[model samples]
Target: MSSQPVQGLPILPGSTFRDPTKTAFHRSQTLSYKNGFAFKQTPTVGIGGTRLYVNQLSQAELDELSNKRPTLTYGQPKQAPPSDFIPAHVAFDKKVLKFDGYFQEDVPISTEEHFRIRQVGIYYYLEDDSMSVMEPIVENSGMPQGKLIKRQRLPKNDCGDHYHWKDLNRGINITIYGKTFRIVDCDAFTETFLQSQGIELNPPEKMIFDPYTELRNMPLRMYVTPSDFDQLKQFLTFDRMVSLGFVALVLHRILSQRTFPSCVLEISDQEVLEWFTSKDFAVGKSTTLLGRSFFIYNCDEFTRQYYQDKFGITDFQPVNIKKQPPEEIKQIIPPYNGYGFLEDSLQNCFSLIPQPPRKNIIKMLENDRKVLRYAVRLESPRPEDEKRQFILSYCLATDMISIYEPPVRNSGIIGGKFLGKTRVPKPGSSTENPVYYEPSDFTVGAMVEVFSHRFIIVDVDEYVMNYIEHNLESFPASVVESMRNHFAPRKAAKEALKK
Candidate 1:
């Protein structure tokens, strides 16, 4: 068989290197030499007879080829240290944005004993003599969005009795902001007077008793206009409105009546002393008339006489003394010396009154027992393919649960090297155990799987035991024993390795 031409050999065209001159003709030859110097000055023959040469040298010749002198050395230019400066814009981020320095500190207003009405904004008077106040409803841009609404006004009727008049006059002094204004007239006159002063007929603000503001310790005098005095006759025909200060004076007078019965004459000389005392007046200790002094007994007869001469008053009115108790008093008080009256009345009247039951702490605990401690075994046969015991504890006050795990030791499989000689427990093996612990303070619930058996933990420890005993009384003894065994402490958990 003919051998195939050698693959990858370059094929030359016919007569490509042909030359007619015999001088260009040359035969190919191979030369072999043991030393490199044998091929030195060898000539190559082709179009030009260029001489081919090679150099043979020792280690000393190679050493002389490189420069021996040291290169010119120059030190690097010196540089200054970097600056620690920061721009203002860059530093502004560190500042707090409280606007604390720009605003003034607030000063609290006093409100003790005195009723203070907080006026948030301006109160506008309506065309019909009625007043309205504005309350902000929504914010549009930066401005308040609201409408003027009418305020409730006192009734203009004269149907209220002495008790109602007393209540209306008890709050004698009304304070707006820090300033105080006396209630010198009944609600009717006071309402009209307020309107005359250009004050809104209906106060639009919240009127409340200031806990911090207190009434002045000294007694105050009240002055009424002549027109108001004339108008008062139509409103308080049977009784008079008084200030809290005057009521206190009246109480003092009543307490010391035996010693200073004549003191009423002095009071009468200064102002009219009405014998009818209203319950409202007794409660508020406020009065309409302003008198200079509460100790009327201190005034001499001359002063009383001078006041009497000036006001055209001659003598004081006598107080009414009743000979027998009123019908109402007799109804409230039982008859005397009646047979079995006290016992029969107590049985019929007081027996129906309800008494609140006392709290039972033990029953409360039993009814609302919370889980304190719980443990659950978390396992996955694939993916992670590992097992871990999770313990949870509940916080009663905060309503939060905290989780804890057992301390783990490296099983000598760190960094892909088995440095430890101890063998680790296989996954899902009975030898895989968790550390034992006492019941925690509180826990809500837990779901656990132990030994391939599932359990839902609604309660734990004594709570769980008590629930099982009470609620599951019908359960078989074996079933109850199994549940108890599941919650029991593990004795082998303390060991490092399993047999």
Candidate 2:
């Protein structure tokens, strides 16, 4: 195929022009033409290979070539739209302090994706010295004008393909076929970068940085919206404020509210007034507007059932919503949009709901109530039986090993079978002694059995085992038993080979 001629204008490859033949190529890319100045022509394909050469030019083409080129070479492409602006939608709920309007868009044909910001203004109220003051603030509507910088599109599934934008100090980056594109522009989000440098967002400003290497991976979290919150009102607890579980639950409720718009009383307009008057939502008696515990359980009973089904849990009840005293309700729950009284019978039971226990990290880790086994170096050198005796002695001294579970393969065998670096014996029992094993098997996240107790390995790996072998003197029976699994299969296989 012949190389297309460059338009009479200065031509760069891959650029489209109305008249390609009149395009003038750089002298480096062309041979001398009839006009003496090298002109770009389509490639002439021959058996040898593709080559470019100029033949002749008309008087009109000569006249066009004589014109001087424009000084600006890298201005916006003429084909780009004159003024581009992204469109967006915004909604609000009562619990939301503010919602930022921005989203990411998918890119077709390539691995890259684009980000968009909806240009919108939000008005809200903030407390100032115990007084509610109306505040109007403008958060930039969408991602600043820049290229999609570092990005990676995760493999697509039912949830749709997800991509991450690695925001450089200067601009957002996106990955296209594993290549990073660092967008160069005046407007970029460097909120995290500035914060790391001890800068605050009292006054929002565009981030500025020199384009460097393109990034291919980064994390992106969707900011929670107020409508996403839930109000269970069924379960409330005193310790909820101290434990972050309450807050996370409240955030989940808010997420659910945002996700399901039809059921809840949306607080967008005078609807907040209706919700405040509704029996489902009781202030102070039901929930303090800002109480984390109250917000999480304020949903209707059906909503609670939905959550219970979704999480595969039997106990979705929030606990003790009907136990509040009227006097307590009067003191804590403030009246919004008037109408505080819910009549005689209902008002008699006005109390803040009792919440469930908060699930903290410590509590979660301890809930299983299983035995904890750790390998300890023996104080003195000992033989195999002596080592077991010493380990048992220590366990006896500490009362730590009350139970143990033996492996499928017993010891006292010459060889065993190997599976994924673990040794399994060819079916022996308590009648036979268990085999000794190498220390490499019982690292973190591994499984081991001692006497009767089954243990899930935690915190140490092969590297640590090696370190202990070099640093510590002896391996106790518990560790030895765990390590034995690694070599059990090998021993069995070797026995089979001998047979």
Candidate 3:
């Protein structure tokens, strides 16, 4: 019934006892589950019985043994199988988190060694959170090197928690067992794994160089001189987008004012070394490269130190940096060479190709090819010049003028184009920025200059009088009044003829 034995009788180790109430006998199961670690067993004086129901049981489990129902395993899906319950190592399988680390071991007795920096690979088994540290074996090394720490779940504190991958990072000091290991770096997988877990690793530090290890490794090391050809090839093919391309520009400036590989390719490596050693490069002086000027206002500490070492010059005063003035964008509009309006020519300039000469559609349609001819005479002292009449025709569509000399029977002057179809600039104005003649400039008795030749407007055509009268606002008030005064007698005669 209970664990109590008969009075003064000791329970044998292998003996089984019967529960007096239930008449059921039980035997001991296996003693320990694990091999060495965490394996503990309590010796029972009595043997096995039916598994004690913790809280409650199903109706199938409470039934008689002879009852043939499927074995009802309450919480079987949630709980581990009785025979297959093991640690998390089975679930994690073959994944190992590795890190590269080193520890400084003090050397108290040896005269040759002050301290020893031993490199070790830290492997953490993700399965069971167990870890092992191993040092690589060196050929002919006198000191014993191999497995430094065995694989086991290392306890972090007395609370029974173990060291996890979360506790390790680059450039951090972690105490494994008693030895303090400085985590300097890690493999690619470990870095990726830590990052994937949302852990930010510190910047990786360089491992301390060990003189003792260096001496042991000197025999196996091979040194080679760097070739100049590779450097020259790299210099020739360097991308110009990055900041280091400034060096190429500087070099091109050092040789002469030209661009790129051509400027630098002419000089040999020996010449380049000489140029670097030369005293030409200095602060406050501007250098022109790639058609652009750059001022060397200041130098970095390394550059100053290099110059100081090479030339024994120490006075490296920083030249004051001046902010460059912003460039002003000026639009130089070309003079409108024959136009309907200046704005239309500018729009043509913005177009992809040259367009047909622009015309004000409304104005052009209204006064297409309409010409206003005026008879003007040259104001010259010569007797024949005052008598010679020139016909000045002004096209209303484009404000362009053409002059013709009519054939005279005995004037002895050839009648031809006195002026081509072009705009004539007004007098007293420079050729570059000039104002041209308009319809208002050709009023009767008015003096107009056409290329330094002055002419007095004698008379205007009948159409010019009618057109000007129709569009009164298009001309100046004074010109309108003068035209009406010059033509009043002709207008009265025409009106009297009509009556």
Better of 1 and 2 by lDDT: 1
Q: What is the C-alpha lDDT profile of model 1 across 240-265, one tens digit per residue?
A: 32212122244322211112234444
Which candidate has the top score in TM-score?
3
Residue by residue across 1-499, what tens digits does model 3's lDDT show? 5553433456675354544666546665536768675654543334444554243444455575335333454332465667867677686679788888889889999999999988898999888788999999977767889999999988777787889989988888888678998888988988998899999989888877788878866777667667555555544554332211122224432212112344434535443332232365677666654466776656666656756776887876876645678799886767667555444466666667856665588977887989999999998988878788999999887778899999998789999899888877788865446688888788998888887788989999989989899989999999899989989999899999999
Residue 95, model 1: lDDT of: 28
Worst 10 residues of 3 by lDDT: 240-249
TM-scores of all predicted structures: 0.16, 0.13, 0.37
lDDT of 1: 0.36
Let me know the TM-score candidate 1 reaches against the reference structure.
Answer: 0.16
Model 1 ranges off by over 4 Å: 1-310, 314-373, 377-388, 393-404, 411-467, 471-499
Error of 1 at 325 (Å): 28
For model 3, which pairs clash?
Answer: 26-47, 26-48, 27-48
> What's the true lDDT of residue 72 in model 2?
40
Question: RMSD per prediction, one decimal?
Answer: 37.0, 34.6, 28.8
Which candidate number would show the highest lDDT if scored against the true structure? Answer: 3
Model-by-model lDDT, in order? Answer: 0.36, 0.35, 0.74
Q: Candidate 3's error at 228, in angstroms?
A: 9.0
